[model samples]
Target: MAESATALAIMGMALVTYLTRVGGLFLAGRLPTGRRWRAALTAMPGVILVSLVAPLVLGAGVAEAMGAMVVLALARRVALPVVVVAGIVVVAVGRAWLTG
Candidate 1:
């Protein structure tokens, strides 16, 4: 019964996520295409990314800080996937070494 309840919760969350993304696409299609609007939309992803990462870098342990630096240094030189994997590795190693 607990497992079934957990599965239902997961499915409900998945549906909400999918609907939110699709709703954004529909809304975006109707949104203004003016110069400023376009620029703001273009910059939104980076803004969201920085908002998410800033808290971790500011408040988290050394491992997260090191991971953020690794992400920054490799951001321009490597593919995004590689940079993400590298950051994960650095954080994992940093935590194990620093905490253990």
Candidate 2:
């Protein structure tokens, strides 16, 4: 009974949120909003990426994580592969340091 009630509540919340998003799109047609709003919406992903990456790059409040982030930035020429290698190195070193 409790589980069913919780599931119902969750579904209700999701339905409401979906409706809100659809409503926003519907209302956008009526609004006199400009290109700036569209541009800002388009930049949302970049904004989110920076927000997510910035803290991780600066520090994980851990030295290994910090070092890996710096090296990742330095290896911009081979960004994807360098990031993968840096991540592996940071994890290996961090694990070793923590365990030993």
- Tens digits of per-residue lDDT, candidate 1, 29-64, equal 899899999999999999999899799886898999
Candidate 1, run of 10 with poorest lDDT? 50-59
lDDT of 2: 0.76
Model 1 Cα shift for residue 22 (angstroms): 0.4
* TM-score of model 1 vs. true structure: 0.62
What would the per-residue lDDT of candidate 2 be over residues 1-100, giving only the tens digit for each residue?
8999999999999999999989977886786568988888779789989898778656654656656665767677667767777777776787678777
Give me candidate 2's TM-score against the actual structure.
Answer: 0.51
Q: Report RMSD (Å) for each prediction in the order shown.
A: 3.5, 4.1
Cα TM-score per model: 0.62, 0.51
lDDT of each: 0.94, 0.76
Q: Lowest-lDDT window of 10 residues in candidate 2?
A: 57-66
